[model samples]
Target: MRTYSLDDVYATCKRRDSWWTVYFVDPVACRAALLVGNRTNITPNAITVFSLVLGMASAGCLAAGQLAAGAVLFYLSFMVDCVDGKIARLKGTGTPFGLWLDFMGDRIRELCCATGLAYGQYAATGNVDFIVLGVAVVVLDLFRYVNAPQMKRVRDAIREANAARTPPPPGPHEPLPHQSFSHSPVPHQLGALTVRSHPVAAQPSRPPRSRKSRRRLLRRFNKALARRRVRTHLISGIEFHAAVFVIAPLLGQAALIPVTSVISVLFVANEIFLIYRMWLFTRSYSAVPKPEKSREHAPIGGSPNV
Candidate 1:
């Protein structure tokens, strides 16, 4: 077994992670990954299974109305979840099955925990609102997971379509002004005349943009966010889960509804903003000029027959 150092473990972590993970979970998880990587024969899949067990135990505690213990167990489960990925990265022990297990396990854990929290609250207070909130939690989580990947695919498809319509860059072997070719079409071609064998159409130019245009403003905002390593969507699935499972419970039953409601609103708003951005992208993509069909024996230096 190969040994790994602390630095090696840290190196295996993602460059950018959710704020909750980066600030709270990572410091502890990095140490855990290093210890596990060097000292044991444990597989990443085993750690993942262990995380699932912790998660289920957490759900049981929550169901039993042991809110404090449940919160602690839930956080521990998240830490273990972070560890498995780090170990996989450090030891190169990751598998496709491991990835699938991790993803599905997260969904199940959240579902069970949501049900546990809501049921426990309802049992104590006889309120139906908690039960409805539980269903909303599950639905929103599923929607975010389902929609995020499909949205990515749509964006990828749009990018590919745009790329297909764009002209390719010059080949490595293509002659530049500074370089000369051995074989010349013109025997004594010199200076600028050596470059072109055929006449290429001049690219159309667009008018300069106003400083206050929506596109320009968006670009500036994006650049500012990038500089800080911050995403426009501040609250993601990880944050949402943490808020519901950890923060809400720590604050007691009274805070649960308010916390969950706030996070849900933010999550939905971000998703809507993402969809709006995609709409803008599609509009721009549609506006791209398509190549017109050429007429038979068209003049090289003149317009084609109308």
Candidate 2:
């Protein structure tokens, strides 16, 4: 088998990941990935299966009311989960099936863990509220996953529609076309609201430029994050999972309810923030320029041959 350095392993890591994994897990996982990649022929799918087993074991421990053991297993499961992808990227042996399996495995792990924690607590205290919390957590997780992709699709569709309607820039020698902005309204459904889109009125054509100061600020921010290997989304799905499975559990069983409630509220707030951003984005559609009629496409001669 071929060997790779630590730099190679780091290069294969995700550019942006959760702070927990970027700081705590990757330091260990990258070394493990290198060792596995260089010393063994173990495939990424195999590691995914192993991680899934660990996750299942963690769920079993939680269900049995073994909080400390469950916490340890859960963290180990997540760390190993992080490793498989790095190994896949390093080895270049990833497959579509592996991707599908990994996704399905994560979903299964989350579902099992949530149910186990709820059932164990309910069993211990005879309180039904834990069950309710479990169901709500699962629902919120699903909402986050489903909502993100659907919203992204809507944004992509909007951009594509705008691109199709907007005409290309004219050549230097080409004369300017006779132009008039259309006031025709195109109905677009944004979430629950259905509104009409009206392109902006004609204006002086000038080269578009973004503020250099703003660009500089953004560049600096990205560089700072890149140094640590994370992204702007500090409370993404990974963090949510860590809060519920690892952090909350480790904080002791007495703290579970409050911690879970707070994390759930944060998740809902994050989703609402995303929707607000999308609403703001819809405003840009009104700025897409309407296509103008160009004489360049007409026949060269005065009239067509009859």
- Tens-place lDDT per residue, model 2, 86-126, is 98899888999999999999999999999999898899988
- Which whole-number lDDT from 0 to 100 does residue 99 have in model 1? 100
Off by over 4 Å in 2: 171-173, 176-223, 287-306
* Candidate 1, 33-148: lDDT as tens digits: 99998899899999999999999999998888888888999999999999999999888889999999999888889999999998988898899999998999999998988888
lDDT of each: 0.86, 0.84
Please, what is the TM-score per model?
0.77, 0.78
Give the best candidate by lDDT. Answer: 1
Clash pairs of candidate 1? none
lDDT of 1: 0.86
Give candidate 2's error at residue 270 in angstroms: 1.4
